[model samples]
Target: MSQHLPRWVLPGAVITVLLLSWSLAVHFGHAPLMPSPWQVVVALGQLAADGRLVRFTVASLFRVSWGLLMAVVIAIPFGLWLGWSHRAERALGPALQLLRPISSLAWTPLAILWFGVGDLSAVFIIFMACFGPLVVTALNGVRKVPSVHLQAGRNFGLSTAQLLRRVVVPSVVPQLLTGLRQTLGVAWMVVVMAEMMAVNSGLGFLILDARNAGNRYDLVVAGMVLIGLVGLGLDGLLRRVERLPGLSWGFPTARPSAAPAVARLRLLRNP
Candidate 1:
């Protein structure tokens, strides 16, 4: 199995070994608190059979989707504006910097007080978790756009809106996509915590409920595994989008037919 396989095979093999070791350890240790992998698998199957897993997963996904959409819509424009205007960045940068260091869990008390333990509270928490980094990323992306492109757009007698639409937005798309991917990852990470504290119907709540109802460690582990797998799937989907032809403008790809100028020069000299 180790001999002639591709590089990706090693990671899967490592994960399998780790899982087998974990299952063996739990089985032999007889630790009632930790459920074996097989127990978690059985519990997950039971959850699916009862449809609770699907319901809870969908609830969490809904919150994350809405939260990320809101973050992207608001953050990108504000960041673009901020990047364009030195005055605006100076005015808001300090405040944002102050707030960015605050952890999402730190807002749990205020989230509960303001929204009172519901979907809104959970969504709000997820939104805040994603917003700050996204803004910063977008601003950086806009700032990184080349001055030549801006000058070229202006030379065409473009209006401010036209310049943004034709020049800035297209140039920033790659960076924005990168930011979006990072923001969504953080959003997913925070949603579970937010749901646990602020909502009654998500994968996070399922884990908490499992513990409280009957100390069901198997169910808790099952919920954790589902969250991990779903997050991985979502990220994989986003990676595919990032590699799409139109969206992947700034990414490096092989140009099989083209040789480097230095290589061409050397070949001509030798020939």
Candidate 2:
């Protein structure tokens, strides 16, 4: 019965505890830097009343969506090709490895120089942040596809393209989904940073603007809360995708009977 409880219960409890602790700290410590959660909530309400919160959130979401779309389009095919051909992976993998370690924030100066402190600059930073992890994950998924599956496809007289489309792609979908979830988190973080420094309109800008305008720590905290909530919602949506029937092959499903059988087999082997 306990196991059947909603998955979110634990997380909700944790968040509640954290928020209570934050409120207490703000009240007791009288720290001007940290606003009580209620103050942030009120600030968010005021922003909503003025319509700035919606505008900033939408702007940030638009940049992230466009950047992620572009990264997915370019990375998938290139990763597949690299995984299929040893020569390509060998030739290109080193460069990717070297570049992957460089933080997306490091690209801000160059992005500003090239795109000139606007939506394009922020989008470019998000693209760079998402691209590397995506390519690496896609390549790994392709390379790890079972050779037996490929052989079976060949035995059925499928051409290389047919085998790839039918077998290789299906096998890679689960891992790709996992990679996308992770890459999206990185992209979200990058967009906020980019917006703070390179762009004039976004949640990040809201945080900075609030601070600079009147030292409104409450509004700054409000912006931070909004970013976290939005990121959580985006991740939750992707998690739902992973549970879809077609994508469930990538995730483990509960099987009580199979677990007992596995335990029995293990006991028999040990005996």
Candidate 3:
């Protein structure tokens, strides 16, 4: 019998190969500005030694958390409303469409002007970055909910609010999770940019300060690496959430051909 490779093997191998190639290229090319992997590791150690690493990381995450919370509270319900009522969509859709096309970066100056150069400005920028994708995903997901599900919800005599709560929201959670995952990436990016100009602390500020203060490209690379690692962890968390029993409909597990077919479909929204 042949054995398949472990799930993590391929990805680990690819990353190992890339790191090795990067180290070799920097060694042979003698690139002065670019830091080798080991140099970046040392830079990370330096950051940790000074305690700036943890502080910066926490600051960035705090702003991102606030922004994500704000977007979810505001955008999800608005999207649901737009999806549920054609009249609401018609009235609000044009404005939403107009703003959705605007880049989050475009809001940076205005954010500073309105919120001032602080945490609020940074959070506002991240919120703007995350808002559009979340709204769009939620709207589309609600629209795609099976009509039968809605009809059954009504048959049970659930009130409009109850129907939306027990019916529509759960129905769209999978898509919303995907939106959230994507928005997490956007939030990280925007926060970093916002921090470079708006705030005095964070990984973004660390990177900018390192470069400006001493041309410490190693610290810059280290900051980038940290961002990538954190982003990957967050994405994986959302992926795991998608596979949770409550949202299994969003991410069904594959069954082996040798096993008997068994559908353990779970509908958490069922009345």
Root-mean-square deviation of every model: 7.1, 7.5, 4.9
Give me candidate 3's TM-score against the actual structure: 0.89
Residue-wise C-alpha lDDT for candidate 2, range 226-264, written one tens digit per residue: 999999999999999988987766312233233433343
TM-score of each: 0.88, 0.89, 0.89
Error of 2 at 36 (Å): 1.0
Better-scoring candidate (lDDT), 1 or 2: 2
| Residue 250, model 2: Cα distance from true site in angstroms | 5.0
Off by over 4 Å in 3: 1-3, 250-271
Q: Which candidate do you rate higher for lDDT, 1 or 3?
A: 3
Candidate 3 lDDT by residue in tens digits, 165-184: 77677768888988888889
Best by lDDT: 2
Q: By lDDT, rank the candidates, best first.
A: 2, 3, 1
Any residue pairs clashing in model 3, and if so which? none
Per-residue alpha-carbon lDDT of model 1 for 173-249, expressed as tens digits? 88888888888889988999888888999999999999999899999999999999999999989899899987776
How many residue pairs in model 3 have overlapping backbones?
Answer: 0
| Candidate 1 error regions (>4 Å) | 1-8, 251-271
